[model samples]
Target: MTSLAAPAATYAEAKDVARRLVEARLAARPLAGIPGPLPDTLDQAYQIQDAAIALWPDEIAGWKVGRVPAAPGEEASSERLAGPIFRRQVRQATPGETPFPVLVGGFAAVEAEFVIRLGADAPAGKVDWSLDEAAALVAAWHIGVETAGSPMAEINAIGGVAVAGDFGNNAGVILGPEVPGWRERPLDSMACEVTIDGRRIGTGTAASIPGGPLESLVFLLGHCAGRGLPLRAGALVATGAATGVHDIVSGQSSVVSFGALGAIACRAEPARPFALGTLAP
Candidate 1:
């Protein structure tokens, strides 16, 4: 039988793979595949993620985390995956921010999530922080929408490893008001619903997110440190979607309700090309 061995890994190889995806994202073009084989492991996938972030000139606005679903009959993993959110793409909508721009001809989805804004840095180089320690770093939490998109339409077809390779399939974040007494609330018990153009699409809770938000933050803090991407103070970390991911298209409006927390509404418009420097402050 012929040998079936994978090629050795290198940062250069990883960066090259990331470069193609980055270019496609910037130009709003779809990508077929990485130049070579896709990253096979989570570590390799994160390497590509870091490389891709380096290629982008925009400032890091925040990070988004998502659960990696376990296989059938297997216990769920405590670990979570992350992606960077560029500053230019972060939006603050009070009660009526309408017509958000979602890229047409791309992998686009919306997720209703609880977002945490960090008050203290969970400095890099430490790997054993507890959930309470991580929660202490949070300054505030908000109900928000995570605009998930990618240049690779087939990204999810390959699994979480591939999604992690491309900025966790994150494109932007739509921030809402801060949640009062968020710490006192039972996040896992809170329910969230997602709708598009007045039609209900999905409903879920923090329990749907592996380990809940605080645990997800703990996982992110350690994961980022291990991957050399530190969790900085003032960064917004949108925890995994409370409501399941729902498909969206340009020209449609989306509304996400988090029960007593409140609702966020935004319409999607076709993406228009613009200079990153102009958008970045």
Candidate 2:
């Protein structure tokens, strides 16, 4: 586990980190290290993330969920972590390769995912959800790719606390076609292979995500509600990665094949800096 050596950060420190991260993101540059002291707890990490969310100008499109491993000397805060996905960053996949922007010198990867789109708003006051209950809210499921990236190069090396603080280490999502009747199929039966630059890198089924993707959605239901950011209709949730996260770079291309169902192809382009108040790609 990555140790959180610094004491819990104060709100001022959290805001400072958030400001630096947001600036770096807008500039499409990399940070040599975390902007400030690493958070000592998950709650502290969320505080920083919340500050960044407030500073960012985009509207939330949905959320992304990732696993949170137990720390060396502490029980895991939760099995999964959540991050906001901005509306402008969400792009629908075309038949040809979609362009995914990756920040040079920053962390970038492709994760095969089973994405869920909500048909209706979640009850704002409901803070607890069961797997079955969470399934009911799902309008449909799809095969997708999570474009995971961050301005902090060592984002993952520092562990989940750092990940949560930096928008759950997410950049955008590439939504593929709908997988009809997904609820009736077993996740283990739906396998996928991920290739980067024409080389096979990872292969797995949704079962790779503990209890499958719905469990990840279940966690987010409670998580967002607790934060008072209840999920709304049409929100997309990129459940935990199905295939392992595979590193990629600018100019690289990736194809995720969900055997028979379909495949998604995308190419990585260097992320460009934009002036504040303008839309982010």
Candidate 3:
């Protein structure tokens, strides 16, 4: 696979590039390229994220995976979309009633995911961590909905490398308040019901994630370790989307909850189209 962990930049420097990619998308303008919007290659992205962590001293909030669903009647386990979380967006957990923003000209969708917070580090590239070792690292288990936006549609149109350079296909996230003992719950058989104003729209099982939520974390730990990265202690993991994306409308209410785990019900407010933010110095 292509990676940014190349020879030119040190791990720290490479991470900065990845963080810059995050800023660019949140600050996109003017032209839209096919393969990518960044001036660098996908291989360079590995370095970008590497540097982002080093120079920024940002919190490794959590991990998020994507495309967890492959076929109908199948599970979310076999799919392969994943990424890390920045600290700022992890804790603003919403339960009861919360308001979420939507870009008038942005791509966003809601998905159901299992949120797992770690008590120990799941360093990247470990051949394997025992279940007890893995379980010991976890703190709380919760069901949450991530209202994520991405630059994928346009970036992927050109090249995956291009998409790779674009923000790890993310915008922001919302956790639906923490659930009690979410990890101990039968996440695999956990039933998820996604509703729009009380109408059921989608259904999913926790086991859909290849190895369930924890397995997804294992994959990420392995993936990052191979690149010389650490999963970090207290990192929250948003295992892939158990239920794929659902279209939303402004001013409409969207609520998603899993059986006895946790639930997120929020009102979608569309932001008026306006001039983009001022250019950074």
Cα RMSD to the true fold for all candidates? 4.2, 3.2, 5.9
Regions of model 2 farther than 4 Å from truth? 1-4, 69-78, 277-281
Q: Give the alpha carbon lDDT tens digit for every residue of 82-175 in model 3.
A: 5556775564655466676655444556778777777777655585765566677787767777766543334333333433344445444677
Looking at model 3, report the run of 10 residues with the lowest lDDT sum: 29-38
> Per-residue lDDT tens digits of candidate 1, residues 66-118?
86645456665556788999998898875774556665667788999889899
Which segments of candidate 1 are over 4 A away from where they belong?
A: 1-9, 69-79, 276-281
Local accuracy by lDDT, each model: 0.79, 0.89, 0.59
Cα deviation at 18, candidate 3, in Å, is 6.3
TM-score of 1: 0.89
Q: Mark the regions of model 3 whose C-alpha exceeds 4 Å error after superposition.
A: 1-24, 28-59, 68-79, 123-127, 130-132, 151-164, 177-184, 270-281
Hey, what RMSD does candidate 1 come out at?
Answer: 4.2
Indicate the residue-level lDDT of 163 in model 3: 34
Clashing residue pairs in candidate 2 (N, C-alpha, C atoms within 3 angstroms): none
Give the number of the best model, judged by lDDT: 2
